[model samples]
Target: MPSKLTTVLAVGGVAVITSNPGSGMHALVQEHQMGILIEAENQQALNDGIAAAMSQDTTQFSQNARRYAEQHLSLEGVMRGYEQLLLTC
Candidate 1:
């Protein structure tokens, strides 16, 4: 998991991340509609991403992020996963 991305999402904050190859950041942002993904090492892209993030209405993004966190990253979810693992073991 992308720890920094998860942290931002868990707190309902929008992330502006670089689209690094093999990083999965793009996929996560696209799948969840949670943040802006910019081309890595591109200053223009970074500027544009920040501008877009600031200009856009982020209510949906915030909601999606919080929902993802609760469903996938919460303590309850982790405990359930552990329980399932132990049951199988």
Candidate 2:
């Protein structure tokens, strides 16, 4: 298990965590923690982990869809929405 003090940040439903390389995918699925892991051993592992995480719950991934829509998927309010999201981030 990771440290109790370990912080998991959800950036667009992607769980940003600090862990050893090649441990992201497992954590995402096995630990039910989605998003990206901090340390990926390689590009391939990162890609595979992303694919696995995406397949696990496209809907959950879609959580950011609204943000995208409010920001870029359309013309009006796109920049404003983006600025707001960025400010929050």
Candidate 3:
């Protein structure tokens, strides 16, 4: 995820994450704790995806999202992961 999305998730905001097919979104969906994925190939599809995300459930994931982001997705966590990978050497 980009910094913008990272900030949103870090602040307990549900994101409507969208990207073109094979261009993005899946890694984020798989890794992030909170957000909806919108995979679109065209303009109309992208619009629909945004609408769908806007209308979906936020209450279900808002509380845990920030904590999850900090513990698993934050810069500190990334540094830890990098350190751990180096330790395998």
Candidate 4:
């Protein structure tokens, strides 16, 4: 199942602000230029990330996020992945 954040990205055009604690979420956000990522458990970093996300024009980020979601997280995309997996099996 897709995470809530992934679902949001798949359905909405919005920027994400999230913490990175060595999870792959940071990589995804960075690779897609989707939003602001901050060090986990750091109040100051979180605050700064939020500030940056709010201050910048996030249109490109939103577009990138949506594009990534469409390519990787959409229902059709997931089905294609599953089909390929079944074929391999």
RMSD of each: 2.3, 11.3, 2.9, 2.3
Tens digits of per-residue lDDT for model 4 on 1-89? 23777866876556545657567777777877876777877888878877887788878878887888888788898899999999999
User: What TM-score would every model get versus the actual structure?
Assistant: 0.78, 0.31, 0.64, 0.78
- Candidate-wise lDDT, in order: 0.84, 0.48, 0.70, 0.75
Task: Give lDDT: candidate 4, residue 42.
Answer: 83
Considering TM-score, which of the candidate structures 2 and 4 is the better prediction for this target? 4
lDDT head-to-head 1 vs 3, winner: 1
Clashing pairs in 4: none
Which stretches of candidate 2 lie above 4 Å from their native place?
A: 1-41, 79-89
Sorting all predicted structures by lDDT, with the top scorer first, yields 1, 4, 3, 2
Error of 3 at 86 (Å): 1.7
Question: Is 3 or 4 the stronger prediction by TM-score?
Answer: 4
Query: Which lDDT value does model 1 have at 76?
Result: 94
Q: Which is the leading candidate under lDDT?
A: 1
